[model samples]
Target: MSQRNYRAAIVGTGAIAHAHAQALLGSGRAELVAVADVDARRAAEFAGKYGGPSTHAGLDDLLREEQVDVVHLCTPPQLHAPLAIACLEAGVTALVEKPPTLSLAEFDAVIEAERRSTAHVATVLQHRFGAGALRLRRLQEAGELGRPLLATCNTQWYRDEAYYAVPWRGTWESEGGGPTMGHGIHQFDLLFSVLGPWREVTAVAARQARPVDTEDVSLALVTFENGAVATIVNSVVSPRQTSQLRFDYERATVEVEHLYGYTDDDWTVTPAPGQEGVSELWAEGRTTTSSGHDGWLAAVFDALDRGEAPPVTAEDTRRTMEFIAALYASAFTGERVQAGQIAADSPFARRMDGTGAPWEKVRNP
Candidate 1:
């Protein structure tokens, strides 16, 4: 007997939703049966373009009409939590976009919703699904890389004023945060997955040169639970753009440089003086899966087929989300933040900027 194929739907017919549609079609494990968008024309156009899947004006209508096994919440950052909660309530899985929720408190609520339902919620941190990341993690877990010591995660991309003119491109209330939360999250999530949990974060954020309310640039010094120290830089004001991550282990230094997604060729493993053997191990069991929405969804589909929770589980993603919160907390508060420190009552838990960003005064005045 053939394995059962699942039915999937895309909730927002945006650019990212197209990626989800393509991935769903390519997976062979799922079929795109329906899509929903607030704009009727957009939904119809997306449906027509992608095999004429049924289209609806809203998620409620889609849920009411289609027997969807999973719903890809490709909407804006702010809509992720509510839509995901709704999916959970309907006993349907929700594969949400990154920065899963606007705040830690919002994420906790989504977790609660998941607990009450038979469904699960997974975030789209596609970087962790790449071949390079998978290989590094496998080697690191097997003690092939020795101990991790230092690392750097940098996302330096340029976005002009016209990009921020979209209204939702840069705002705490709408988009959740600046580049730290929106753009650089992929690199840092991969970092967190490889290094385990973080211990503390000291950071700073500035609007820099962007014509927006949120910071265009932010930097941080992070200490991991395993004693590895890493520096992070998130910026949208750089002239030249690149997304880079470097991990310096006792035996080897691994690095990948790419602007967006990465393949195996983008990665390099340089062994220590006496640990030249590490390079061969790095290239031995490699696959061609590049980091993107498709590869990540494939892993998610595998878990669903096994009646298991998805790869980027809520607990694992919460750690990364917490790190994001802590980065902003430390940046705006001018104090180092520790893991499990953003209590429900804390301002950072409610909002990324806590009471208000320090630069808010300068911008308002």
Candidate 2:
């Protein structure tokens, strides 16, 4: 098939939008044709800085006027579904940011919209595309790591009261859940990508620091279907910020440690006992920096050109979202939540905090 340059656009001119713009421009597989934001000035300013892309005050105008092949939805969590649906309905593929939607219910709606449209929706879970992560996955799939036994995913970052000054920063209705949904989600998504589907989750959530309606910290014990258990900690109260994931397989232990993003150097492989040769095998393939949006976008464009479903498809993202729902459900109900337990009617599925925001009643410590 002849390669065609894909035309792209970005919606929502927020902080993350810049990353999207950079990745789209750098990917070379696609051209950023336009950018849209509710704030006309912000849109115009972003366009001025990004170069070449036109600007629109609203997505309606951009979708109606531009012939865009893909759109990066960089808006707040609450706006992801509606905006993504709009793009998909307009026959444009959508690549949404993390916490893809405020809740699983909202995500389901996005999936239904996708079924009726020619275009597809893919969530941004960039960590899965990193070179180290990809290598780890290959080793695991090849049975070189043996059967996975244990894992840990920690997203410990600091977000002060000032950081929540943004209207949607720490709210159940807007930003979705706190660190579990927003920050740690990247690490956990990568964890799930490597470990596979989770079977159950038991969790606890708290408003440990920030005076936000959502919990600033959460901890969960997840049991994967493969019988491997993982301890997950999501927190915005830690003074030292880091994104870490460690998987202990039968033959070797693979670990990645970095803040925000990672590179080849961030990954380490330690063999168990007499299994020293595993280290050499782990380094056998291509070595590249940690994958980011650019790496994922390159793959997305390749899939588009081939008329294939893009990476991080809704079905793929649903596992991560389902885990988020199960975490919140288990935390709020004080019960172990099983996968597929959060039906459409479940309060946690409908909203992150269940029936009501817990922090609303408790005084911030």
Candidate 3:
């Protein structure tokens, strides 16, 4: 691919949408063509701030009006898959937000849509682009971590009732799940992206919110296909903190101790004195790519520029969504959800729409 300026549009103008706009604008690779949101004011605000193109009512209007070559879907989880598919159908490449869709079925829809269209498709897993993420994968693949054994991810964030006051939030209908889907998903995305797939999940969810039906606290045990076990603890009850993940392997234990984002010193691969030196040797011998643009859209731009696939692909995201779906099923049924067996309309399917935990506990704290 020859070097050329790319035109792009962002589909959401909410809190996270700003990052998309900024990343696209600053990357010196793609231009901020347009942004759309249901709230016209929000869309207009983003349009004014980011420059270029224009805003429209919703995704349909935006897609119909803009001659955009790339579409960045930063909408809520439920809208990601459909909008992505819509973009692909329009012959436009797409980069969707995290927790790609409400279920694996929807993700499969995105995949099929990708197959149906010539557009490049990707899941927005920007966390996988971080410097730590880049270096860690190199070590793991080179056997620096040996055979990974266990890992833990803790994502605890605090949000007041006012935060959930947004109509779509705290409801299973709009935002997908609660903390596990909204907040904690970032850390775990990095987890599954690096550690690979899981075989089973045992989870427990609690309603600690003010008056929402979605879970506020959740804990789960994950068994990876590679014979590794991991634990996940996600909550909205603690003080504001950064997302973190710790990986334990046969040769080393690596950790990202910072939340929001981290680059230097946030990750470490430990060794038994001199045993894992082989990994160090391998790392020194090769230099790949690592970047701070942790969103899928910017990474997609780079991939297009290089004629390569994005680091986080649709199948990669499906694995995490697969884990999440199974976790919810496991929580509701109080049983172990065997991987590959948890499918749509399974016996353990929880009432997916505003019917989980408690709205009360989620509201106050």
User: Which candidate ranks first by TM-score, i.e. highest?
Assistant: 1
Q: How many clashing residue pairs, candidate 3?
A: 19
Clash count in backbone of candidate 1: 0
Where model 2 places Cα greater than 4 Å from the true spot, the runs are 286-288, 361-365
The C-alpha TM-scores of every prediction are 0.98, 0.97, 0.88
Worst 10 residues of 2 by lDDT: 356-365
Which model scores highest in lDDT? 1
Clashing pairs in 1: none
Please give the clash total of every predicted structure, in order.
Answer: 0, 2, 19
- Candidate 2: clashing pairs of residues: 130-291, 263-290
Sorted on TM-score, best first, the list reads 1, 2, 3
lDDT string, candidate 1, 313-358, tens digits: 9999899889989999998878999999999999998998887888
C-alpha RMSD values across all candidates: 1.2, 1.7, 3.8
Ranking by lDDT: 1, 2, 3
Residue 94 of model 2 has an lDDT of 92
Write one digit per residue (lDDT tens) for candidate 2, span 1-365: 66778888999998899989888778777788899999989999999898868988778999888999889999888889999999889988999999899998899999999999999999998999888988898988988989999999999999899999998888888988899999999999999999999999999998887878889999999999999999999999999999899999999889999998898889898999999989998778756655778888877878888898798989989999999889988888789999988888888888878866555655433
Residue runs of model 1 more than 4 Å from their true location after superposition: none
Residue runs of model 3 more than 4 Å from their true location after superposition:
276-298, 306-311, 347-365
